[model samples]
Target: MSDRSGIFAGEDPFAIAQGWLSEAEKIEINDPNAIALASVDADGLPNVRMVLLKEIEAQSAPSGGAFVFYTNYGSAKGVEIEQAGKAAFVMHWKSLRRQIRVRGLTSREEGPQADAYYTSRSLKSRLGAWASDQSQPLASRTALMAEVAKVTATHGPNPKRPPFWGGIRITPLEIEFWADGAFRLHDRFRWRRPDPNSAWEILRLNP
Candidate 1:
């Protein structure tokens, strides 16, 4: 019947992703959750950067499933996401020799979930979030640290989440899992849907 076995065996793509991430957490030397997030600006020029994926919501989530990451809403990528309403990312684990690619709809997650994550950060990080004008040209390191000092003095130890910062969730229309194989041939399985509410159609692709 279906050849999807071992690491590729899972009914739900989101579940498969979470399981893979859990395994990576044990052996990945660094940030196992890092993703190369891709977005496009108003001009249609593409941009991509590495960002830590904060969470992977399961299929039971209200939005079905989503990959979440936080950043300054005023940042370039944030502005692009707001403009385009879509984004893509690839989470590659060099240690595990595997990767997950996703492309989908984007939305702001600025409610309680955002607040809780913001609150979980270290005090300096919280203050730094308030201080830094992300993706903007800065005068120098001195200027940045000066601003950090200023925000630290003003916001104190329990600085609240900055108004310009929160989570951005990408609800994928397509999710693909790929693993390294012997002899340069790779195993790939793509799960795609027409829209957020549609059921996924799975396909095994050529290497």
Candidate 2:
């Protein structure tokens, strides 16, 4: 792994991903933590959208590690992911000329971690979570605002996290690190495994 200009010089893909993200945070103009999340619907149609990555858990015994983010459980992506029980995402930083892609199994994190993250958000956002019927048809902007106002009043200042809002964790089965190079000859190293419990098989791929 170290041969690829030392960028992928790590046994742990989670650690490498964390390192690349840290570098991106220093130089990327905005939303350095953002990832393009992908999921598939019941009919096997694909969907992708941008979301801020909330955490990158290091590799451990049981959980092994995961990428985490929050969203409304009833949203299109959430429903899609639940249907497929799998997801993928890509983190691309133009400033660093690097990208990391991950494909994995999905699971819910609706316990204390989800609650804590929800509490850390702004009051308006917490209320908004309770107000909007995400990915569903809305009558008008006025109607949406009115719903928000109603929820604000009902939930008050320190509202609890909505039952339908929580974290989604993606435990990667394959992770690929890619960096741009001279003459478009990029470097790539992929860590693949059948499941989280299995050992990784690393490969250097032609770019």
Residue 34 in model 1: lDDT: 94
How well does candidate 2 match the true structure in TM-score terms?
A: 0.97
List where candidate 2 sits over 4 angstroms from the true fold: 1-5
Native-referenced Cα lDDT, model 2: 0.92
What is candidate 1's lDDT per residue for 1-207, written digit by digit as tens?
189999999788999999999999999999999999999999999999999999999999997999999999999999999999999999999999999999999999999999999999988889889999999999999999999999989888888888899999999999999999999799999999999999899999998
Task: Report the error of model 2 at residue 117, Å.
Answer: 0.5
| Local accuracy of candidate 2 as per-residue lDDT tens digits, 1-207 | 457557777678898999999999999999999999999888888899999999999896356889999999999999999888999999999999999999999999999989999999988888899999999999999999999999888889999988899999999999999999799898888899998889999998999
**Any idea how many clashes model 2 has?**
0
Q: On a 0 to 1 TM-score scale, where does candidate 1 land against the true structure?
A: 0.98
The per-model lDDT (C-alpha) reads 0.95, 0.92
